[model samples]
Target: MPNIFSSLKNAYQLFKHIDFNQLDALSKKVDLPKMVETISSLDEKQLSAMMKMMGGNTKKKELPPIEGDFYHLGDEALKDADRELQLKVRAVLEKDVKPLVNRYWNKAEFPFEIIPKLAELNICGLTYQGYGCPGKSNLMEGILAMEMARIDTSVSTFFGVQSGLAMGSIYLLGSEEQKQQWLPAMQQFKIIGAFGLTEPEVGSGAAGGLGTTAKRQGNKWIINGQKKWIGNAPFAEVTIIWARDLADDEVKGFLVKKENPGFVVEKMQDKMALRIVQNGLITLTNCEVDEEDRLQNANSFKDTAKVLKMTRAGVAWQAVGCARGAYEAALKYTQTRKQFGRPIASFQLIQNHLVEMLSNLTAMQTLCFRLSQLQDQGLLTDEHASLAKVFCSMRTRDVVSRAREVMGGNGILLEYDVARFVADAEAIYSYEGTKEINTLIVGRAITGFSAFV
Candidate 1:
């Protein structure tokens, strides 16, 4: 009697999904009563299988948590306080900077509003020892740099120019008075700064081939010629301009104030990547700077290279951030976007792309970790930084490319965020140092041959 009742219940449940009209149509062609009896005689396993065939299950599928740090580098490697700082920086960037980036990027304008918010983090001049700077490890600074670029590379570049290049010029080579006057305010983002190393005609060759000239006249120096692609130059209070001196025919650093009548900066436009950064074309027409304002110890281009070498490692970390951002966005998108009645992430090709991106990103992160360690130990050289820069930037381009490919049509749209990452990756590949230039730097170090002409 119990078996009879269970069979009857299963038959009733099956009838719920059947259309009565369709059942009537089938009744004329076949025996409906006999078919029902056969179905009723079936046990629980058969009934459950039939329901599944009819698409009865409606439960939401569970997916893994979305995280770009697949290796737990942040969790296992950093100490308690350091991990807390990392999370703090990530929280600020995700909350304050992420939402505004796509809009400003579309407009090709800097969101001036976020400056005070970022300044509140007090992370500027992160590795510097004094002058209100945080005396942190190079690893910490590199990690924070990654945090910034993860959200927006333009924001990272803006901060790097202020903290690493411009302030570093003063901190490393400036007189005591210069460091006292500039580092504190710049560290707090009170006075924005710009670095003028790349010119309209000179970029990688600026080490020895600078075209801008500085001619001294007793207590003052006249800086002439134009500097191009100078980040923050349009509105920075001070710019650390590198010019060839007429006396020694070597590179010299000058503290050129924006208010000076001879100094002029025009905004550069029509950029496709890192558009939020206010890159400027600077024209120094006999710009006179006080002798005291000059970087006292920046005697040659080698001094300038010191700043670049230190900051290039940070650029490598920024590349990792850019790749990580794209990878995470793509991963989340694939898990949610449905195709052929299932998540796209379930497809083998899509998963392959994701794993490749993760592999490249992990490699970059580990290399940068060791690179920063070398820097902290004072064992870092030009070739070390350049190697990381070349490898990470190249891999970033590949990761973003695969990220966009996985998103298909949605990848190119700014609404998806991957589009911005795709465009910005190109800029990272070219800037700091071009891939060919950096490869040669490594090639020279390993082969003991100077390939530069």
Candidate 2:
């Protein structure tokens, strides 16, 4: 040992300059004396190169940044312009909404200041063909939903209520004159809208029966009932209220103007989740809506189902964003949060959790992407949308939990962002349709059995 590399004085000199700690650690893993003896046969040039390789004699190479968008679906799946629009939407959210999200969530207040900033993007009714809307693909619309919820699901819910549900109702069921009247302003965000399908007594079973009733008079309809968990209802200019028509006993849609004397909304308070959203308990004390305000073609529950069918895909996309927000946040946290003098991200156990999150996130994303594609192809079914909604929402809950697990105590704090995601995932899970209800929807389609009572 000493007679081998010890005879080569120059190679032995390099070893003397090397850090003893590094040598000791390396020696624990390898036979350093024999290794140095073997390398001692190399010439001066190889010896210098070998010394530099073993030590940081040269600059360390930089990696191309690891991020949670693990697959560049935003960059690769979209066309040049569409991809830019996606980035632009993300930029707006990060600049305007992200900074205020935790603060607003803490105060349980809505940020009205960003309405014009969001409106300036002209994304409302993006899939609708007229009324100053962009008339984009369903995929683009879903992408926009994802972009919104990735930052804040409350904003996503707000946007989807306006762009997808409320406007979608009028677009799919509104008459020509009705579309002319509301679609243009709503498309421009001049009139914010809320959808009132879920009542205090009914949510999953709203399709079969509605507590809200509309009695037709000579020229108007009187709407009387209460709506719960109606997002944006407190400030919505027009709320699309679903009511049971007294004469027909069929579910009908009515555009109830906020100015209507009998229409009142009390802001819901002390919600454990989605606090940034302004959920309202709406009271309609004989809310008089003109016959024209009633969705003319909306004669039955089927008409309402059309809007839900389309919006369900967007809800699934929202879940994808929720999971993604958590995954990305957790991954970034792991890379920076040092444990044992190294990044927790470098730890095998932490990385296992990160990969699991990404896998679930990716599965959700690809599933939603295809679901939207089916929508664009005119091949989307209730079951298809339901399947995605059920799967994404359920998986999102798991993803966010893992995300929180990785962050330790900071995961539950609202200021840290992951906590909000964990809270919001609960809303997305139960809303649109509960897991059991959506499962039954899919089950009915495949088995020809109605599982719901």
Candidate 3:
């Protein structure tokens, strides 16, 4: 009777430690009932010994903090106010935007609900000097772009269209009245904006081959053409359209309002990347704009290139953010995902991939940092911005690819986040400038020979 009681007590202890789900699988090869019986028959001492052999430790080991800023740029470089702003944005993004991104990304829909919340941050036109702008340094603007893209590249692209490209055109080339009318409302997010430059057939050739035409009438300009892949076009209150002038054939910019009779925007669909952004196909059929709405100083493509140069540096920082997000997500996933009874991150090969991602991310971050500094010091050139964009965008693709690889099958899943980064990296690689075009820009500067025809 005492032996029976001892066996039952030992069985209870053994069952407490045994994983029955694993035992069920083991049953496929062995007699699980018999194995349980054998375990029950063991003495208390044997049960304890068996539990110890099974690694008796039930406590989960704490993982290292998930951080992608391995070089401490935020901590070591940013001033107190700048760092606070960065963290504030990061906290808001993780709390509000992060939760809804995957759902919206899957549906290929924009979350208009967050626009008000984002406006509350008052970060638009961050680098502009007046009209309620923040008047911050270019470095700060670059960091914020990184922060936004780190959470969602779609959001960053949306903001870039608003703050960088569209607003930048007016700020750099608009009349004082134009700035006064648009900058304040845009700074407050009361009015949304979009940039229209690339037409249906002209992309890299937009510098010299803009197909959109703007003919100056008695008191207005008539614009007729199609602008494709214009971010924020579908719902933007205003769009900055670049068109070739019929008189001089030089490219000029116009502020085309949404209510214009000839302006129409159709939402682009079935995009594989940056799906949260509502890219639009804008068709302007004899769109008439008052002479006042024409950008006063944007007389030629060279003036338009000024805006592109300024925004290209921000795009480089955006690549860093996308790569950093993917690397951090992959790093966190590997630390928790178990394989062969240990974390996959414990394996040397996985660590190697993680280190490679970090190396690329760090390099991109530092490069953009210097790029922003050059802009702040009035030393930024087309070649400087182009080199950073080319190198960082190319490296971002590699980092995101490795990030997905480290996550294994989960890398492609949107719920994992790395998959979105992987797709969005392709867009970043192509937009603002393509890899080949940017490479040629840098090559031209270095060799003093323009490869572009």
Candidate 4:
């Protein structure tokens, strides 16, 4: 009896290794579980006869690896080098950044180790000419923004602050000498930068209601006031501080270095979204900057709007990435998770959720692609960006919500990846421009009436 038991155990172990496709084919005609149970109760002769009845010609079908970009937009659109760069960047985010992002996000701490590799990408000032910049098209810049936000939005925000808002201010408004002085090092990430425009009291209204004041005296400019939600300001080498000129009543941009005697930055804590972005409450109390540090061409608030115009489009792209990330995570989750003895993804209701997510995601990708194209052609308007921002941000909220819903209880947990997108979407919706503000921008363009007060 002991010998028979040992033989039966060995036979069952070998049967377990049989190709699933063969089992599936056999299952079409036979009651597999009943047959297995009956065979287990049979003598060795009966089991051998059953094994012979089943042919060994089954071959496994190799399915393509599951990927997020279902439409292959990324592969078809990007040039070979740009696509390679995108893959490299994605690899870094997947291997190094994604694994550690959730913990840092929970603790609201920035990951400093990835900075060197990020700097090596040489993507800073990607759309700018000269000054050690990559001088790529705005489309490439937008694509990179999407790539970053697809993994972690806080890091994307940090990069946007340094590369778009801060460097763009200098690139667009700085004098030739100012560009020569700052652009090279800043472009290489040797010196990090921040842009301070939003105040504690003013956010979307900053263009019209800037409370920070800058008074020029002799060759120095005295800037006084506070800036809130200033990303990267806590550790930035230099900050592009926007303050209303006391002399001319015009908005001006000043380069306030971190070591300035009167410049102080306190980290803002307890943020629910983009916590790893290192937002700061910056106080400029009698902070004096040399004339050379003032952005030479930033004569009015309109100049600051130029920088916003460029970065806002990138924000729209980020929204698409955030949605893509959540949708992909949810899609992957459904495939492996089992319920009722089958993959949850195989259910009709679950497939409906996936299709909805894919629909919104596809729309956002196409919208951002056109937005970037318009930007590259220098034909982009505030309304164009606002439309994309409004549509993508709003739809992203929906996509992430559905993504969470499909995952059942695991959706709300940070480890699942969908939860972060759900939280981060709020910040993206509000920043750059609020939904109402952006919608008003679009409304005014089509109707020829400014509804904003």
Candidate 5:
């Protein structure tokens, strides 16, 4: 051991340059006593070399904020409280959802553990006026949808089928008794809901050509047919099954309980996209439904169209999220992944890809923001929603492709996140409304000609 006085002198001189705050932080990082002892054994020349290296002028420049929200809409457009909720949901996704997404996606299973916590957020039935829902504006709902999709589109779709499609069917068309019986528990997620409308035979032309038929027999309606690509069906407690009323020759929505003897749901397998979502093929053979369970005010296909109009906006928001998530992931990878001893992000070609992604992402966000505004104002027509759905889904495919291009092989891997976005975007593009169907909706509005066949 060195003399106490000499050791004290050397330690004091060595630490003199470090301010107290930094020293305190350093002490928390390392064992100070062992460091002091080890340093005391160093010769004067060695100590000088160590000190010179430690004090080398290697200042790291702060990187610019690389966010997918290239536009300031999250801050400028949302109210303070809405913005706070937006960030809170985003935090939950990044912290809780992202880590387990790949494993669940790989296994093609849903993470049921996160459901209760999500229910606790009380965001279900977001646009509804009562029955335990937050009664938040359409803008808030759209933002939350975007946030969920940004992390994982499968979860967003599951939630949408629950909150928007199933609940909206009841809220917009159900009688007071129907709403009172189901809305509260459904809003709390205690009784998860599914919306089944598309059949194996009918998809794009659902309005005019529904195969599922409901025959009213005395006090009960007998529902018979199949629903394909029904999200959350296998696990949902209640499913809103849309079928044609044989007497009226019009579509009507029915609430079918999972335990009902006539209802059978089988999980669809080998799905390439949104695999984490529990989609099922539901077959209803003589499903007995009381007249009370029918959506009382759903007299025709027009009421079902109202529910579709509302949920379609949510799908547009989801498409925006899919693009944003992939863009952010690719941008981060470029900055960290190096080629030829330098980050690929520094190259002009890579930067060009990044810029193209940002441009598309920014446009999607802004478009969805305005779409939600129109929804809130009650100015959202089928054509308006369809136009947004068309534009955003198409642009999202472009953005995710560029994001995949930037990362090369890693882009195709599930672990890199962009791959999942790429796959999920395909489902978003086709579902809710297909590209061709939505195009005609807009075309009919612009030209006053119903090009839809």
Candidate 6:
């Protein structure tokens, strides 16, 4: 009533310079109980004002949530139910997967325990129709890819091999009986699947120069060759081996079971990236498949490209997730870590690093969103998917590098989370199709010139 706020502020200023340790010693010579009681009796507003005065302009602005998707692309675009599912999946990854991921990454092992929980999500074959698949749009599938990869890229890779490459091969080209035989069980995680495409000497040029060969016998097709970097092949119950026909020189797909006598898988080791993914060097020494097990409609490399064209969009989404994960980790670290007696995030130079990371992340996310839209509309071409893959993978490298830079030395430590993304990005950059191959696909579309040669 009588300008009590001003009086309270002055009293707070008086107490501001008083050292609590020195005050404790001085209290022995004064009426300590009365002085403490007087200070404690201040009302809520008075106390807040007094604290503000004592703290001396320490009222920092509350920063918004450190979201990697600054443009709210996910929120603005996803339907209510899809958005809910997205968050639910993210919570599961954070609670169940994120806590245990680094340990598995260190050991280069898969957490088989998560298979049951992952199966419960019922997200396999997200875009395919029937055969226990979700039959959702490609957009949803892309989002789920991002969600899985946000926590562990290896798990995402495992899932992609099963759902996109292996299952997709069957879904797109197999006979109805084939889909019925594989999709339901694979969808439930009862049967794991791997895709074998790239050979040791035929990586980026695999589409044209597949070295794996399949020779037709009386009632069986005998496959012979090596497949390098076949994800999940080491443990997959079924591996879809792509081999060229000796008769017509056409590429064909075979569902090679793990117990096949002539099929051998050696676990690839000493990998510098995506260590948790069990990539295999698969050797097919006269691996025999019944004609019934052959992918019925897969007659040529074009059918195989159909599978790659579909999965390549998902790979682009995975790149976005990788970048988002790294950017978010770095942003949170910068906000709390202090340099020169202030939070490093408060500095302009550090803010510039953050902004650039966000810019790249946003660009990747938006591009993937559009790519998924095109896929959903049934307008997705190889060139469109390839362009997104190339752009997102290339930009993700930049984002992860910036993320590591912002964290200084801690960025390289596995415990920090970003180092894994940084390392995993290298694999994402190379796999599916290398940057050069994907760029050529897009290059041909824009200029109508085949630059792949």
Task: Output the number of the lDDT-best candidate.
Answer: 3
Q: What is the lDDT of residue 440 in candidate 6?
A: 88
Q: How many clashing residue pairs appear in each of the predictions shown?
A: 0, 0, 0, 0, 0, 0
Model 4, global lDDT: 0.89
Stretch of 10 with least lDDT, candidate 6: 1-10
Query: Candidate 5 — what's its lDDT?
Result: 0.90
Worst 10 residues of 2 by lDDT: 56-65
| 3 or 5, greater by TM-score | 3
The lDDT of model 3 is 0.92
Residue 122, candidate 2: C-alpha displacement in angstroms: 1.1
Q: Compute the lDDT of residue 39 as modeled in candidate 6.
A: 59
lDDT of 5 by residue, 207-236 (tens): 986999999999999999999999999999
Put down candidate 4 lDDT per residue, 91-203, tens digits, no spaces.
88888889989999999998998788789888889999999998898888988998899999998998999899999999999999989999999988889999999999989
**Candidates 3 and 6: which is better by TM-score?**
6
lDDT of each: 0.92, 0.90, 0.92, 0.89, 0.90, 0.89
Q: Worst 10-residue stretch by lDDT in candidate 3?
A: 9-18
Look at candidate 3 and tell me the lDDT of residue 332: 91
Off by over 4 Å in 1: 1-43
Q: Is candidate 1 or candidate 2 better by lDDT?
A: 1
Could you report the Cα RMSD, in angstroms, for every candidate shown? 2.3, 5.1, 4.6, 6.0, 7.8, 4.0
Q: Local error of candidate 2 at 444, Å?
A: 0.9
In candidate 2, stretches whose alpha carbon ends up further than 4 angstroms from where it belongs are 1-66
Best by TM-score: 1
lDDT of 1: 0.92
